[model samples]
Target: MRMAKIGLLLDEQAAVDKWAKQENVFAFYIREVLDHLGIPYQNLSKETASLEEIDLLITGLLNESQQALTQLLSFVEEGGTVIHLSDSPKLANWTGYKSVCGGAGYGYTPKELGHRKPVRFLKTNHWYNGEPAGWNAKSGFLVSGSPAGQILSELWTVIQAGNGKIVHCQADIPYSIVGIQQGVEPILHDGEPAPDGTAGIDDGLLKADDGFTLDWSIDRAATETGMKYFSEAHADKWREVLVHKLAELALEKGLTVPFVGRWPEGIEHIATISHDSDFNLEESADITLSLLKECGVYSTWCMIEPGYERPLYERIKQEGHELAFHYNALEAEGGLWSESEFKRQLQDLKSKADLKTVYTNKNHYTRFEGWGELFEWCEKEGIQVDQSRGPSKKGNIGFLFGTCLPYYPIAWHTENNRQYDILELGFLTQDLDHHALADTSVIDPFLEEVKRIGGVAHFLFHQLHFLEQPKVSEAFRKLVKAARANKFEFWTSKQISIWERARRKVKIEGVSASGEPNVSGAVSGANTVIWVPVPKKADLAAEAAEVRYGHLCLKKILSHKQAQTS
Candidate 1:
C-alpha cells in the first residue's frame, strides 16, 4: 500500500485563482471537504508542476502550455487521478469528449423566484427531507453530454481514461464567491427579490428605492445564503461525489477507503427537543414541561424575559431542564446592539432565573439579520450555541440546512476569515406553523428521513402555542412516544453541541508511509468514529488499536463503483 497524496493545483494565472485569492471560497471549501473526510492534501504551486508521490491531482480548467499539459497527461497515463473544477478543453479532447465553450445559466427555471432549493443529489435525485421543498433552479452546462463517462451530477461528469480517471465539473459547486461576482442572482430570504436578486438576505438592507446603497458583494452573497446555496448541505452534494470517486480510485489501486462518519458513536438516529419561551406565560410552560416530564425527555427552554417568572425558572432548573436566553425584544428595535446591552440583559436574566451559564439562545422571532453583529455579541456574552436560524416565513418552513446537524457559522463579513464561536443549531419543525394548519404530522416524514440518514430531528415547540391549543401538547406527547418506540435517542441542545465539538476534535494524528493510518481521541459517553485504513481487498477491519465504527450506528459505505452505478 502507498500513501494517498492529493495535490491541489494553485494556478496563479487562472481567473478562478485570482478570485479565490480575494475570497478563497473554492480552496476553503475544498479544504473543508477534505477535513470533514480526514483526508490530507497539499497545495501544488506553479514551480512544482509535478509531484513524485501525488496520487491525485485536482485543479481548475487547465490553460497551461503544451509542455505542462503533456506532463499532466503523462501523469494520468502513468496512472493518476485528475479532477478539473470546470470544463477542461485539453482534458476533454484527450479523453475523447467534446468540450463546448458556452456561457451557462439560461433557461433554468427556479420553482420559486426567491427561496432555497433542497440539496438534491444529481444521481439519485433524492433530498434529505423528502420531495425537494424550498426552491429549485435550472442551469445549462458547458459539457452537456459525455460519451464514455458517467454523469455524477448534471454539471459534474467523470470518465475513465487509460488507468486513471478524469472528473470534470461545469457548475461552480464552490460558486459562493464567483457566482456573486458574475451577477448570479438568488431570491431573498423573505421570499422577495433582492436589489440584485440574491437569496436568503434581509429585503430591507438591499432597499434601493429607499436610496440605500447596495453594499453587497460576492463575499456577502455567500454570507446571506445561510441555509440555501453555499451551505453545508449544498457543499456536501459535491463533497460526497468527490469522496465516492476517490474511494473507487482507492479500490482500483488497492488503497484504503477513507470517510467521515455522520453521527457520534455511529448512532443511527437522534432527536433534540426544544421549546421557545416567547411569552412569560407560566401556565403554557408548565403544561409543556409536564408533558416532557411524562415523556422522560430533558429539553432546552429558550426564555425571553426570565426576570418576570422567577419561580417557574427555578422549577425548570429543579426539573433538570436547560435554560437558554430567548433574546428577541432586546434585538427587536433593529440589527444594532452593543455587547454591554447583551451582557446586561443576560446577567439580569441569570441573576433572576438563577442560571449558572446561559450558553444557548433562540433570537426572539428568529431575527438573525445583522447576524454578524448578533453572533459577535453572543460570543461577548458567553453564548456557545444559538438555534435562531430557520424558516420563519409561512411557506419557508422546512429543513433549511438539509440535515439536522449543528454547525459553526462562518462570518464572511467583519471577521477577517474567522468563524464565530457560537454554534448554529438549525430549526427543523416549529409548533406555530404546523399548529396553524392543525398538523403535527408534518414532522413524521422528516423524522423518518432523519432515521434513514442518521441525523437529528430537532423540534421547536413554542410555549405559547401549547397554551393557545392544548391539542398541540397531545400531539407532542404522541410524537415523543412514537420517536422513543423507534429507538430515537433524545438529547438536549447543549449535549448535542458538546458532543459535536468533541467529535470534530477527534482526528487522525498520523499516517505511516506504508499507508497505515492512526486515529486517536474520545468523547465521553458518546460514540467516536475512527477511520480504518484497509486494503481494497481486505475486509473492513480496524487497522489500529482504537474505537471501531461497528459499535456505532453506521450508514452504508459509499464506494466509487457504487456511486457511478447509482
Candidate 2:
C-alpha cells in the first residue's frame, strides 16, 4: 500500500484509551472524524515526530509541549498544512488564534438574537463549501487572533504560510462532535425517569428526552428551530466540514487523497425504507409489500411482539427484503423496558421469522431506555446495526441525529472510550407524512443534502400508517418515484449495515498516474469504485466523471472506475 500523506497525531485506538481514561470523552475525536470521512491516514508515533514525508496533520490537543510547538512552527514555515483542534493558548498562539471566554454553556450555547452582536451557536463553515455549509461548537471560548489572517465564523482563523496554511479552531471541535453525535449522558444515569407524561417510574428505563437535551434547562435556545426541545445533532456538522477541509488542504499541497466512496460501486447516493409492524398485522404487511414491489424497491420490515407468521417472514425474504426485530418497550403498550425483555423479544422475533440472522433493529415508537445499554445489548445479541436514534418530533426532523452515515457508536466517559461493534444506522426522519406532526416540508431538503454528501437517506414508516393514512400511502409512492428518478438506490437495512462494515476493510493498494486509485477488498456482489482528488483534470481519464467540489480550494473529484471483484 502507498504511504498516506495525511497523519493523525496519535494511534487511533490508543488515543481513545489514553484520553478517555481521564473521563473526558471529547479529548480524542480528530481521528474519529477522519475515519468517518474514509480518508486514509497513518498515526504519528509521537507529538514531535518527523514531518518530512507528511503533507498535512490534524490533532486535537488539550495541552502542548514547548518542543512539540517549536517543531510544529518549523514544519509550518516549511509549507506543511496543519489543522489544529484546541483552544489551548499554547497551541493557539502559533496557529494565530487567541482564546477568549465564549460564555459557558453545556451541550449547546445560548443564542443571542435581535442584538447588535448576536452570538451564533451554529456558524456557517466557509472552508468546506464556502457559504453553504455550517457546523457548531457544543462549548468553547471565542476566537480571538491575529487580524492579518482571514477569520472564519468567529471560531477559527486561516493563516497562510509560504506554501502552507493553518486553520485554528478556538472551540474544541472533537468534543463538540462527540457531544452532538452521542448525546450527553443524563445525571440521573437511568436511575428512573417518570413514565412519559407521568410521575417517575421505577422501570430503570430512560425517558424519551433522557440522554440528549440541549442545556438541561427549560426554554433553552437551539439551532433556530424555535423548539425548547431541539436536537444539537443537526448543528453538529463539524466532522463533515473538517474532513473536507483536510482534503482540500491536502490537494493544495499537491496530494491526492483517496477515500472510500460512501456508497458502493460509486453510486451517487443510497437510501433505505423500513416499516415497523407495531400491530404485527398481515394486511399492512401485504400493502407495504405490494407498494414496494410496484416501485422495484426492497425494504426492511421490523416486527413487534409475536411477530408476523413464519410464512409471511419467509415470503418477505424470498422477495428480496429483510426481516428485523422491533423491540416494544412502550409501557402503555405492555412494554417492560428491560435488557432481558429486549433479548427475549429479539429471540422470539427471529424464531417467528425463521431467520438464522437478524442484523437490524429499531425500537417501537423509538422507545429508547438508555444510552450505550441498548448498543451493548445489540452487540451481545449479534445485531450488527441499530436505528433507534432519530427525530420523533416535527421540529426535530432532518439532520437532527447529526448525520445520515452509519457509524459505530462510541462508549463515552468510560475508561476505555470503547468503540462499539454495532453500527448505528441513524435516519433523517420517520414517516414523510404520517404522524400527527408529520411535516413533509423537510423531506426535499434532507434528501438533497444527503445526496450532496453521498450518504444514506433512511426513511421509516409504520405498517398501520400505510393501511389507515391515505396521505402516507401517497407520500410513500411519491418518495419511491422521486428517489428513483433522482438516481438513488433503495437498500434493505441489513444490506446497508453490511456494506458500511465491509467498506472499512477497503484499502487503496496503489494509485495510477492518472490519479486513479487501485483498491483491494472483496465486495461479494458489487464492484469497487474509489474517489480520488486530483488538481489537474487532464491527468484523469477522459471519460471518467469529475465534479468540482470545494469552497475556496478547488479540486476535481474524479471518480475512478478501476473496478475489482471476487
Highest lDDT: give the candidate number: 2
lDDT (tens digit, per residue) of candidate 1 on 468-534 = 8777777788778878877888888888777677655555544455444455545555444435444
lDDT of 2 by residue, 1-566 (tens): 23248766643443555565655545455655666546677778476577888777776543266777777777788888777665456655555545443422222122211111212222122222232124443221242222222333434556677666676654555655555566656324543332232223234554433454333232122333332222223323445446555655666655666666666554778889988887778998888888888888888888899878888887888999888888988888788778899998988887777777889998876667545778888989999988887755554455544567787777755535667888887776666666564455555656776775577888898877888887887888888777887888988889888777766666665566655466665555665556665554333335455542342221223222333341
Model 2 local distance difference test score: 0.62
RMSD of each: 10.4, 7.3
**In model 2, where is the ten-residue run with the lowest total lDDT?**
111-120
Instruction: Return the lDDT, model 1, position 460.
Output: 84
TM for candidate 1 is 0.69
Model 1, global lDDT: 0.54
Candidate 2 has what TM-score? 0.78
Clashing pairs in 1: 108-138, 114-187, 116-135, 117-135, 186-197, 186-198, 187-199, 265-527, 266-553
**Total clashing residue pairs per candidate?**
9, 2
